[model samples]
Target: MMTYQEAMDFINHIPHIGKRNGVNRVRPLLEKLGNPQQHLRFVHVAGTNGKGSTVAMTASVLRQAGLRVGMFISPYVEDFRERIQLDGQWISKEDLAEEVSTLAPLFRQLQQEDRAVTEFEFDTAMALHYFARKKCDMVVLEVGMGGKLDATNCIDAPDVSAIASISFDHTQYLGNTLAEIAGEKAGIIKMGSRVAIYPKEPEEAMEVIRKVCRQNSIQPNLPDLSQLEILSCGGEGSVIRYKGKQLHIPLLGEHQIYNALTVCAIFEELNAGGWDFDWETIQKGIGQARFEGRQEVICREPLCLVDGAHNPDGVDSLCRTIDRFFAGKQVTVVMGMLEDKDYAYGLSQLAQRASRFIAATPQDTPRALPAGKAAEIAKSYCQRVEAVDDPAQAAFLAKSQAGAEDVVIACGSLYMIGYAKQGFLREE
Candidate 1:
């Protein structure tokens, strides 16, 4: 049997379980394990974006409600341990190792029995087992990809299903249209489950969500847009209306108001179901919750801003926030992206807000845009664009060129932000 570290190292070698769609692999594994997932309650979250932040907020609120909550989030910013949390803290390394070792034999036996589970399937099962062992009152599970056939969707109906914001992403696996993407996200909505959706004012995405809810006989609670008022939106942060109270979220970006509203709506649904929570607790949770790599500010000396804006709309939002707060400030932008993403669209959006652009590619799976190629795309929007394959070196160069008052914005992929934090911010 492999040690936990050894098992994690081994799993890393198995390419991510993304390209393949469907719960075919996880279903049988759950059956073999007696479906530990069934014993646990879930708050399943799925959407094109904001789902992670929404999960964070929901878990915080649930914790505030005095429930033992287990959160399983993916695409870790720093450590694999960050992906799993209990009572709002990262699962201890010793416990993480113990859990992995305890489950290793079962996973191996299943493989020997000719059940070749993907890495995600194994991780999903591990999360279920860990949550069940801890007897968590509820598990906040974020879908790895689309909702319908995602490995995380194998569990029984969640207590509440929440869809953050829907948009066009993963076009190859999901359809290429907003409606098609919305349908994939909407798959998590079970019959009779009360759903809280971020007010997707956009016509196309909302239409698909409405159609799915109507078909499944699910009651969709669309956010009352009229009630959500952005009191302050900029570097200082955003203030919004929630459950008839004005709340301020520490996270930057106006789009975060949508994330906050989603959390408020979910909490409202849970409250109506007999969970008692005061607005003060909700405010504390919102203010304290952190979502790394999305408009994350790491250094004030250089005024560096790191964000994981990999798509058109994401970059647009980042650019809008940058303009709103850092307007008239000469900004040095460090950028990188996966090759499959709309690199041209993202680059164009940031190019307009940047004084200088440094493009790089971190260690990522298939489709990491080569720095040279990313720079080529960036050049269409700016003349001061440079390509460096090493993300750390790129951040250093951007900072070296930046003036005292100039802002350094790392806009592209989360990998870039992770690299920047690990490599450059550590010394600072």
Candidate 2:
């Protein structure tokens, strides 16, 4: 038996295995491991953006319905434990450590027998094992990258599959256009599975989803929010009238309405499929469900908000949210992004929303755009673009310039959100 420290060391060493993009790498090992992923009912969500929020919303609704829910999300906002949550709480460190210790040997054997597993595959396996051992009633699993080859797709099938506003993202792995990306996302739509979809823009994305649904004999239902009586509050979340009752979600942004409606659609589908859940519980779950790094409030002194908006769609949503909530306010933005992303487009979106900008590089990632380069790119639109190599320093400058009424938004990548939350949001 390996000690916890030894397990950590072993798993940490596995990080050097580099990125291998394909499903073939994970399937055999998952099969050998008794396919732990098959043990739990799943609500699988895949998309370019809003996947995390959709998962959170669905899990919240399920939990409210009184089911023991397990949630697995990617690109941890704060801690690795955040990736696996039972009900609404983060998994205890001791439990995770013990599970990691027990799984370490299997991880090593898989690496020795086949090729090494990517960090994502290793974590996805861990989440499945953990959720199964915990005997969760349902698990909300978020696809890490593109759906087809994403490690989380190891699950044979899910009770409900959802695509949350697919757009042009992960071009290298998924495809170059919206249709290609939508096709990759549509891979989550299993044959005979019930699906909930937010209304896809560009029309072509919806066509891809519809074609996939027809081919698989899957029922894809696009949520109709016209029936949802929406109440938009300034700077807070939104309240909706669903099934003749009021429900509140502590998340802002109109894009959230689509995610919220997707949750309702999933619940309705599940209910019709013989799963029982009440509307009150669904509302409670939506109100209680929380995920950090998406429009998270870090400081009130100067009203700073940090969101992980890495893609153009996400950036546009963030900008719209800012415009609606903080219009006419002086906004200073702290930004950092991965090199391979559509950094230029994402930067343009953020620059158009922010009055000033500070750029920084996150720790130990080859894909990170250097602070100087990011600042130079941002300078094309904003008059004041400062390059700071350290995230803490960038936050400091953003906060320093922000007045009492001004708003500070730190955004770009999940990597940046992790550091920003730790450096700025970790309140005493």
Instruction: Note the residue pairs that clash in candidate 2.
Output: none
Best by lDDT: 2
Q: What's the lDDT of the predicted structure labeled candidate 2?
A: 0.81
Error of 1 at 254 (Å): 0.2
Minimum summed lDDT over a 10-residue window in model 1 is located at 13-22
Q: lDDT (CA) for every model shown?
A: 0.80, 0.81
lDDT of 1: 0.80
Q: Per-residue lDDT of 53-165 in model 1, one digit per residue for the tens?
A: 89988888788778899999987776777888998888876777777777667767877887777788777887887888899998999998889888898877787789888
lDDT of 2 by residue, 325-389 (tens): 88988998899999988899988878777789888896657889999998888888899888888
